[model samples]
Target: MTNDEKVRSIRSKIKCMKSTNEQGFDVIIWMRKRFLQSEAFVKNLKRIIDAGFIEKWTNYLNLQDISQRLLAREGAIKDPEIKFEEIKTIFVLLLVGHALAASVLILELWYSKRSRKY
Candidate 1:
């Protein structure tokens, strides 16, 4: 299947899985695997970044604060160096990244359709 099709399929799966309680944390892992790592998603994300949406979104999200919190959490972890809070932060970052990618794709699709309608 094409990359766009793959992205659509993954998005649909995410919507479906999100509605059920069976997967739990596995749903996040699955989303990271299927959406964040998809080739089309990466390409669209790069395009969005090139268009400066990353800067705009990051500013809106106050990512610097999130980064500082993540750093503090990292410093607090000893020996094993992996804490649940750290994992949660990482997961939240992944979700934010995925949201950005999906938003870009949606905008692109919407623009394409709007242009076609004109």
Candidate 2:
């Protein structure tokens, strides 16, 4: 289990991936498929986050302000620095990122619209 899971488990154990309908303590995953601790086994689970996902982690880890600290932090597997020479590689990365964003936005819009349709 990961640190987040350990935190949750400390808070009376949520048995993993079981979500609740509470606020502040909820992880609003929406269209985002993976989180830092998300494992490969959790494939088709939609909006996967437990009731104790946030508070449990925050308190257990003493993060206090994890959101502000980790605001847009990212790293590369091998090449940490960006090379200006690989224009095609950069373009491909941009394209993939944009496509993923567009897909998420479209999914959100469609889901919202569908909810309204009911």
Candidate 3:
């Protein structure tokens, strides 16, 4: 299949998966099992990245992360052990730090641009 067709297929699969009743860990696991970990999907992902669609993939990951966290907490109530608390906590902290670092870089870029306008 062409790269565009591959991308469309991957996106459609993701949309269908997100529409399912599964949430958080289950959704992630299912996606990994069904699509994300597949060779075809990886190839398509690399093609998309090479085609300069990084922002689209980044947005998708951000959305998936939000969905996972929102449902993960609810899932934890039913089975606390399923949450993997320590790992989740570390992952969250790392994400926060990454966001902070990105924000700082963006601010620096903005300041530099503004200074150049003077």
- Predicted model with the maximum TM-score: 1
lDDT of 3 by residue, 1-118 (tens): 7545655555544422233334322112124334534666657666765685654555677687778788888885354455577589889999999999999999999999989953
Instruction: Report model 3's TM-score to 2 decimal places.
Output: 0.29
Q: Each prediction's Cα lDDT score?
A: 0.59, 0.49, 0.61
Clashes of each: 0, 0, 0
Better of 1 and 3 by TM-score: 1
- Candidate 3 — worst ten consecutive residues by lDDT sum? 24-33
Q: Per-residue lDDT of 1-118 in model 1, one digit per residue for the tens?
A: 7656655654443321222233322222233534545785546645765687644654645655566668788896345667788799889999999999999999999989989953
How displaced is residue 50 in candidate 3, in Å?
61
Model 1 spans > 4 angstroms off: 1-81
Candidate numbers sorted by TM-score from highest down: 1, 3, 2
Off by over 4 Å in 2: 1-85
lDDT at 15, model 1: 23
Task: In angstroms, give how far residue 34 of model 2 lies from its true place.
Answer: 51
Candidate 1 Cα deviation (angstroms), residue 17: 52
